[model samples]
Target: MINPNLALKVLDSPFHHTVIHNFLDLDQASLSLEALAEQEFIPTESDLFSYSASNNLSISDNPDIKSLYDSLCSKAWIRKLESLFDVSLSGNVDMAAYVYMNGDFLLPHDDELDSRLLAYSLHLTPNMTLSDGGSFDFFSSNTEGEAKEIVKQVVPKFNSIVIFKVTPESWHQVSEILSDVQRFSLTGWYHG
Candidate 1:
């Protein structure tokens, strides 16, 4: 990790989230991208999302990928997450790399899976801009806890990681990619 001692800002309105910039050093980030690029990605599409994704990174045989996955599952990493989120983590994490090409998108939805306490995305795509159109957008909820309109647009800056607490109101989505550039990132959840 580049910034091992991370300083996080918690936002409570739209949803609880923290964006950590410079999450990994350039060398490590490049290596991670290389490893992930070699892995096969399967086309995945549903009513809510469309993209290509790798299998669970925990099962990867590549040393570089395994090291990264192990680091995330490490005690130090869990401690930092627990401290920052103010929640007890079960030390189990599921991770996979995703590539969203032109026209790819994910609709708004709260990550309320069983035992999922937090969801995260680590951006690895360099030179991605606002014009790229693949941003992590957070949505405000109605009084009934249904997702309404987008309240926050988080550009997926290279080497940045976005973490958010999983709740019924924690609705977010990846805006459609209008550009031809591929939006690549590693995403997953931390179990309670």
Candidate 2:
């Protein structure tokens, strides 16, 4: 469930992004995230990014993780997000668990894709800090439309969620992880 106040904050952002803390039931979400982290992760690598990602997690065997995924796609949840962002979510959500270890990073890019209306990341990292260098950095374009410096950086924190409207100017990246600890999160896109 989303708070109306938080939704308003997201709607009022420069590029329309809102960060929500305690996004889910803390105890239940934590347990599920821990279970999801134990599963096998396939290596996702490219010139633009490097990280480990799981297959579509909606079919997860872990009950808690499955529930979390289900809620994100549920009609009720869709209504909540739609009410806030003014986007018509198709009630179809694609999501997966991701792991970023030291040196893992994603370069800046707009998450432009067919059917995608919003991009989201729910941080499950238990004890990460800014010093860890794995923050979700948001960018704004310059006059000529080139990607500019990061305007906002979100340090991954347990039970926190970041929702960004996926548009041409919505460029963002995951900064390199400097710590040895693994950075964990559930990320996905909601379709229109």
Query: Model-by-model lDDT, in order?
Result: 0.89, 0.84
Off by over 4 Å in 1: none
- What would you estimate as the lDDT of candidate 1? 0.89
Best model number under TM-score: 1
TM-score attained by model 1: 0.96
Candidate 1, residues 1-192, lDDT tens digits: the string is 445666767767677788888887678888998888898999999999999999989888998888778878889888877987889999889999999999999999998999999999999998999899999999999999999999889899988988999999999999999999899999999999
- Looking at model 2, residue 130 earns an lDDT score of 96
Query: How good is model 2 by TM-score?
Result: 0.92
Error of 1 at 80 (Å): 1.5
